[model samples]
Target: MTEGKWDEKFVVFLKKYYWDDILQLANSYPDQRSLEVDFYDLDVFDREIANELLFNPDEVMPSANNALQQIDLPVEKKLIDAKVRFIKIPNKIPNRDLRSKHLLQFVAIEGMIRKATEVRPKVLNAAFQCMRCEHVTMVPQNEIKFVEPVECENETCGRKGPFKILVNQSVFVDAQKLQIQESPENLKGGTQPQSLDVDIEDDLAGLVKPGDRVIINGVLRSHQRTTREGKSPFYDLVLHANSIEYTDLEFDELEITPEEEEEILALSRDPEIYQKVIGSIAPSIYGYEEVKEALSLQLFSGVAKHLPDGSRVRGDIHMLFMGDPGVAKSQLLRYMVKLSPRGVFASGKSASSSGLTAAAVRDDLGDGRWTLEAGALVMADMGIAAVDEMDKMSTEDKSALHEAMEQQTISVAKAGILATLKSRCALLGAANPKYGRFDRYEGIAQQINMPPALISRFDMIFVLLDTPNEDMDSKIAKHILKSHYAGELSEQRKNLPSSTITQEQVDGHMEVIKPVIDPDFLRKYVAYSRRNIFPVMEDDARDHLVKFYMDLRRMGDGKDAPVPVTARQLEALVRLAEASARLRLSNVANMDDAKRTTRIVYSCLRQVGVDPDTGAFDVDVIASGTSKSQRDRIKIVKEIIKSVGEKHPGGKAPLEEVYAEAQNQQIDRQHAEDLIARMRRSGDLIKPDKEHVKVV
Candidate 1:
């Protein structure tokens, strides 16, 4: 109960079970000034000792510190402060679950590190010298504000005069502040995550980086929040970290029950696992089987590789969907948001570069200190980011993703802060065409209001067209009607005072669009697979990819021509195959996985990059706005117009004469007309009148 008795008890408890560990720590002092002791170890030694520290941390912590200082060792070197860190607390609390009752108690909280401030020194003990009598007094600083002696300590000079702080005689320690938020995977439904501020001191400073899933053991303390209106009654809670440890697997943050783990393992062994998972992607949407299948692979991402040359290759697959309206692009995006373990859904229309990556924000959160805020992409690290209306993003905002997509990192150099944050998430973007509808005759880059350079970064680009087909339309109508009916029934049951519909009746109606795997189960399955499975490429799979690339390259070997497919697509194939292998929970990607992925990639290319004139795949079609054939025709038509204008005395070419010249050059009149319109749109030519044009 008393302070000295409490200190003696801590010394006795440490000597009983940790005498050898203390000797080892003393031997390694200064070099290893901290001794990490588990709370369970103390509980096993004496449960009362653990309980006393957890309830009365303020008194017990210093007792443990004194016990460490009192340990005798053979080394002649004086030990610089030694720390006893208590870890492995059995009952760890979530960030959101921390309550007012836990104040001043030793508690363990688990979450992802969202932001961290730079390390700074805080004075702990200040020695002051009074100018009146040269008397010295020591003051211990406890709060955020510095402390100074009020008067001289000598009896002869008890003056209330000024005293100067002895800076050299004062002791200081490294301190850091952190913001930890609950991991996205741990959240259910659409619940926003809760965060708490933490104050780490001494050796614990700078031990963590942003996006790290860590379990921190510390005492919960409260500080009064000071507002512009002056000191408020509300107190803000912050954890004073005593020990920090990284969670072994990112998936560990998502607590998977034993029954759920069994179900996941069993599902992995199913032969129809891939189809079932794809069906579970966006079941409410009528069709887009290919798109849903690709999204399924996105959930089970491939393992990233780090080469010996100090370079890295990202394994995340990036997909872009450019389509007409009412094609369920937004619905699919929202579904992926729930499927991926840490997915973030953001609208490109409202997202800025700083909102998607990282920002150096100056706010009252740190009392005017610049704080680095983690954005959507940084917070969704090792997960998926689904951006709807991707075409609506500003040019500068879209450019921020170039490095995040490829290098899996965001480098910030604003407000005198230079820091790189991890953003290793797969991007799933959906955009609409310029004219609000997909144009099969036009290039994808030309149809969408996005730069060619940004468009080419996507691993696969699919064009979803809303074409009228009798059979497809019937199926879509039935699917939409069933979805609407199910929704109406659910809403009616909720609104009615006394409902005739039983629970069984409601379940039967909802089962029509129910996913093969429940959302919760699918989340756990994806997390387990991502955390445990890292597949390798089999020989046959490797050969399959190699032959596909070689065959596409051979198509460009006829003459001086551009390559049909770049090596980027090859990497995409590998990532897709590995994801397929993960669905079966296999360590090696086989021929079957390779065949499925190859077919998917080939389909994507056919949809977006195929040159209609040559009937061959052309990478330039997607990388730039036009293929070689289209570019050549545009050149020929421009030359003809230029030549016709030179022949004319007025320096203008008539539309009819330009058409005739294009016809003489073996160009179709209709094709020439389209090219002329395109040139006008691009500002390459000026239309003086309906019948005539002038070269710009």
Candidate 2:
């Protein structure tokens, strides 16, 4: 009698036919009639129904008592009608806990799951967020878990970490995973309808169409899928997260409001606010226009602590600013910290590794369990984090942030807690060129406080040279004086007209931009980036590489900040350019962007890259003034090896003996070691023995 509606009848049939024990209702919606019930539990639960019903702690059902009897704790206990006998047993035992290792054991046994695994159903909520400004969000509260840890490349919002989890209902149970189409036909307006990998098995992989949130249990990858035979799979299943469960629901039938619709519309129209906050103070710090531009990008696109719109942050955008003493870098950094919605600016010497990411500290709240304190990056996630005096920090502390900057997530095993935190944020940083001041004509790398591996992750770096000129110094002094004493400089801005867009509006942009990118140009561009652009070899290679990037971008409508060129290489290309372009608030990637990225690359390349002449790239050429002695030592080492054997007419000497010779010249030990490494790499010298040296 109640089965007249086809949808309702289908739901009933599925419940009775597909599942068992269907009476207990899970959470529900407005109309019970519209609800689809699960009767037969699927292989979704981490435990059996019986075990879960018995042991689960969150539920409040009477069956829970019958479900679990008791667990035997490690301490032994016995009772015999008020009479007891004591027995002693040694602590050592044979193979007390011998079990084969499994991935699940790693996650589950380590308390990922508090109960035994079982067949079950799962429901979760998630939101799609823009990585840049955080002005965009799409939350499907009644959906499956679709959030995976990722670095957010939301334009200037260098925020990174665990992104919004998609709701359970947004998943598609019957779509297919599409193939990667490289042809022009597929390339133009290339957006294929989104489908699930498990369903039709032919939809686009690692992609989410507008208003679409996929719920699957593997890491979501962003590129093409292929096999061992060199043949492309119909779909590239780029993994985002693993071990999945799901349910899908349509949005139209849900109780969505027009206000929500309007918010979505408004978000679609707001121009990309990849423009960084200029914090009036930064502009006041004269000279270092290049450094200022770099820092501006850091506010908009570097490793920030948060997204501008207050969304989850993720992904790569590391940056550093090296300058001379009295360069006003710290003052500028302090101002930037306030401009960001969520930001932290701290001195390098004052921070610990734990303070940079996480710390197990005594919480004054009085819970004896030590609590976790998120450092500048973690707390500033989804926003900007300005670090002052970078070189003064400990090497260990600097290393702690390497993963946070690149991975956009912070995993810590501190106190009694094993936790992974989201820390996707932009980073605006400052440092002295060395313990003293910078050297004119030198790249900032000479005095960087961190490691080279860490250095490479930054989208770009800038040198804040304080070259004193008669005109520039006077200007700087006057500006500082004005900022300090002028009553006109109170921290206030002229009231701008009401912004047409709200944070919520920015969070709702799918319906607008979807039509713009239906061709999936972003995907192709990303592929091209990963495939080609980033690892540049030579000048000609850079020329050829840029075309692929330009062509891929030409494929997309210019609505966003030359949005995601899927490839990390493409990101490098775009990032380098955009960091420059952001300086003047231009929406497009202009010459400035190209030059900025190229300069940073050039600076880095100059340090490690080969030069045709003199057989050395010459850190002295780039690392000019920070340390004359260091540069001299690099040259000295080359000269020494070149002079060895040929000048004295003897077999090549041991490196130790070479160092002994260097010591005679009053060379510092650290400087001597560096000289040897560079000499060995340059083919000027070789290790005949582990410690012995020879001319190459």
Candidate 3:
């Protein structure tokens, strides 16, 4: 059909199906310049027109806009430049699947916004004035290159040279560029994700930001590849976006069938559900039942609270594992990533601060304009980010995680771009001890390479020591051998004929190493619980948590006693209890949930927060890198050095004299020497010579 016929059909279709919508648009003109038309509605009206709109949007779009302009309305309410945008396009395609056939075709693609450029005015129509004739001509701009009038339309003057743009008469629209990447959850088998550039104009320019998951309905357009050599035969694809729909809910992408929902509900009702979940996580790996239990709770995280004051308290849990070499820390992290609804795994040795958080990068697709690019944490929003070799990251780079872990947001103010991106994900970080082996006698803050402030933010810190024990070693060896045997048998069965290797024999071997629940089912269960369950703490549960916290605090009531625990631990306990209730699909967190969380918290505290010298629970060891007893002893030693230095000529106390005075004050000689060495390393004391020391 001709363009005029298409316009007439669209006008009739709109009047029949969208008359009320057109009237509403007429009332809200200028502010809302675009009218969204559903593709399904268009299909219902005329199937051929719907098909043409998807295949030849460039031809049909303008005709639809012309039809919209022809609609009858009040004299002052008539729209001249109103747009007709299509939504719910059925031709959904993945980023990697887009090809030449899809170019210029209307399609819907869903992904997380990996990068977005700032909105800027783009010329849509350029009015050129002939310098010689002083006549203006209007030209529509479509391509990347600016267009100018070919020749003057004056009856006598037909000059083609020296045309200048009339700035006041040129039409401009707000335009922005975004790079959308395949959502991490959608990629499988370690496949690298692909991204596509999207151009949005007018009302759609500033509606989305980096880290937002959206489905963009647009027409795919191709641009010739250009380099320093010249334009190449190959072309790059870009989407001309018409509408943006946010998939903001964490589990919106996850689809649970009715049968699967029944199975999930049945699993939640199982009396042994907790044990089954713990056993399902890296079942091939031996022992650390408590650690597995904590990890299970982390999967069904606490409810995020939004206070009336407009501040948000994050419910996502952050956990750290400090262990020796040969442990299964990395394996556990990998398993968690696989089980999460959306996950990203990155190693600190390879990831920079920007790679782990967000970066302001120059976008090649946007003519070298600065854009905000999301990093691992941002991409894993409402999911899990498993970071291995966390200690390998530089202190400067690790500092970037402080805000992301607590506030669940990454604020970037670099390269003339300032933006805050969401990183509302649980962090499962694995680190190696500074000395390559965890020391039970030393504080966790001293053994781990991470800063004390950062370490303190973790809800739980587990120390996996590779201690040599005959019974435990034997068990671990048996488990590893069984896992290998299971794998060998499975491969043999696959290669051999059915008669040679019976299925029952392979199943017997597999049972020893197989997960109690399938990983895929576990992932769906986690997503379901996170989507539906928001457990409220019952009074009994609240009391249980308060009582536990008060009892710990009572241990440090004396004037000189160390603080047993802080309010942070209480908050962590509450989150854990809520997660426990969520795991059961319960609406209320009761005393049982509270008790379970308290037990886990107590165990974690005993491992990392105990003071070696005082043999007491002192959370200061983890929170401040120093126990209260150690701090007091250091203070006494400093006083002794000051008093003894006055008698010396250089005001530097002799090492032997300071130690003697420290011993006289009841501080151990060896402990005093260690304290002095620690102070020297920390820059609080300077060794004037080998035998003398001076306070800085």
Candidate 4:
């Protein structure tokens, strides 16, 4: 008989007799060729029984026969043990819609996640993507094959997978799941939607074909939803992941050198030079030494690393000022934005939600065609994004922001397109208090129009208040007047040299910057932090304070944020004092380095700690309108005050109450007392001829 005919006959016979058994026996077979030997390649299905039973495994449980009881289906190749059901959650397929994806030019795909569902008998499907070689298939179930399930179809080894399981078990928040019966696994924090586009439908929809690098913008969510009878329990899909995040492309961009980083940082370090740059604009943001330091930390770190989100901008910094107008907060933001490499200024109230993360609806010449544009965050990637009037944005805008700020990405679903885009930018935002002034007595949550959960995400929170002072006002007035008039002067006229520096200058420095320790340095620093910083103990908060010092060292060595040894501890030690030393371009982190970082972090942490009696931290310790750290300090103070009066009330709390407030606010003792004194003198509180005081 001919080889093809012989193979065909073998396949027919196998299908008739052992189709189910072959699938069941798939586990036992060394490889497909084990069965392939007998049937050859006459027909694709010549090995159908083996393919399913061996590879697919719809016929058996486990290894056909085991203690776990590899129960095989009836008429299966392997031995049957008992009745067993492989309960799996279904995943979603790649995008099936094109009109919504809105494919365009110069798009770079960064990442992807699964859209969650909250229906019962939930189908756990494709809300996230895991690559399995050239055969990129999305499995709704968590059990997507990690091993290569097939041979390379081409000359190259095509049938390969990630060699790993990419799981993003970050805190998933699914409210819809809560309404239904949910397992402990589904009940993660915040029912939060995932980020990035995991699936695409077509080329036109920005769904570049499988393996075609693409960027998409869409709301990515992880959820649980009930499926119809006879199907899996939960179903998951990448609902646009949604935004203009996907496009057919990749980027191998250039970077600047360390020398350039050193130069820029050195330039910034000099108050004279730094002041010369923004002196005309931000001359009078007085007394926020820590705030200025934090800003400087972010500024140098961001620029020093030649990339955003580095040590300079850890975990995506976000700030909101709840102060009365007239504070130099806006001025500070303006100057910083201008100093940044790529930044855009927008108001919270007027900025559209979509406009902040993405852009659409541009008319193309007379046609009804719409153009897609990157939003402030997307365009600001690798840079900084500044927003003012933050309280004015709608709740929808705020909700949309929650994911972007944390995950460093955004999803969009409007203008007939669903997509996700990169919004990995430093967020420096400002807002006025609901009372139009710093309400030292209220919860920070209530003062601004944003969620506590969102507020908690910021690395540091500083309140900006228009501290009433005659001398400071005079200085601010004179400075503003000088800047206002100086604005029209040309670069030469001002004798300030150049108004702006080009990216080239920055890049030139990045090119030569050598890695003192490389990424391993970060690992060593993180290890030190975990060991020293994570431990909670009783040592006057000093011995346990190695954590803070270690972190400072890490930040210092990081060139952007730099080294180790001190951050793991919580008590006051170094950072605040050394300040920018950790961000120095040195290859190694020294003791002095750790000390510097410790001082700054300590000050910020102390000012924001809680005071139990007062129900908040000693916020008054850190004055407003100058430093961003004070914002967080105020937030802690507000929470402490709100909770304290409710749980344990006195008509008032004493100076020692600052200690309790510091504890509650996670601040240092010194920070709390400073606030007590400041508030008392300012008359923001009523000190009834004694140590005890209350909000005025």
**Best candidate, TM-score:** 1
Q: Write the per-residue lDDT of candidate 2 for residues 1-696, one digit (tens) a residue.
A: 121232233333434443222221111211111122121221132124323322231231222211111212133421111100001111111111212221111011000110111112332333555444553444443322344435555655656644554444333321222211111111225344222222111112223321122233222223344579875745433222222222111211223346744543343244532221222225545455445545555544521135677764343356666666776767777765654545566677888788778777664323244656556677566566777777778888888877777777889997787999877676767777565875443344455556666655655555655665898778777766654533222222123344344434333432221223222222222222222222212454356447755554453344322221224435555555544333333345545456556555555343332222233332222322223344556677656665654544455665665676678787857768866876677687777668556666
Give the clashing pairs for model 1.
none
Query: Per-residue lDDT for 157 in model 3?
Result: 93
- Candidate 4: tens digits of C-alpha lDDT, residues 31-110: 22112112222224444433432223322212222312232334434433222111111122233222233232112224
Candidate 3 lDDT for residue 175: 94
Ordered list by lDDT, greatest first: 3, 1, 4, 2
Clashes of each: 0, 101, 0, 158
TM-scores vs. true structure, each candidate: 0.78, 0.40, 0.76, 0.39
How far residue 644's Cα lies from its native spot in candidate 4, in Å, is 23
Task: Tell me model 3's lDDT, rounded to 2 decimals.
Answer: 0.89
lDDT of 3 by residue, 461-510 (tens): 99888889999999999999988988887888898676376778889988
User: Residue 249 in candidate 3 has what lDDT?
Assistant: 39
For each of the candidates, the C-alpha root-mean-square deviation to the true structure, in angstroms, is: 6.0, 25.1, 6.3, 21.5
What stretches of model 2 exceed 4 Å from their correct place? 1-281, 302-316, 362-367, 440-444, 481-485, 488-571, 576-696
Q: What's the lDDT for all of these models?
A: 0.85, 0.44, 0.89, 0.44
Error of 4 at 97 (Å): 40
Please name the candidate that would achieve the greatest lDDT relative to the true structure.
3
- In terms of lDDT, the poorest run of 10 residues in model 4 is 175-184
* Candidate 3, poorest ten consecutive residues by summed lDDT: 246-255
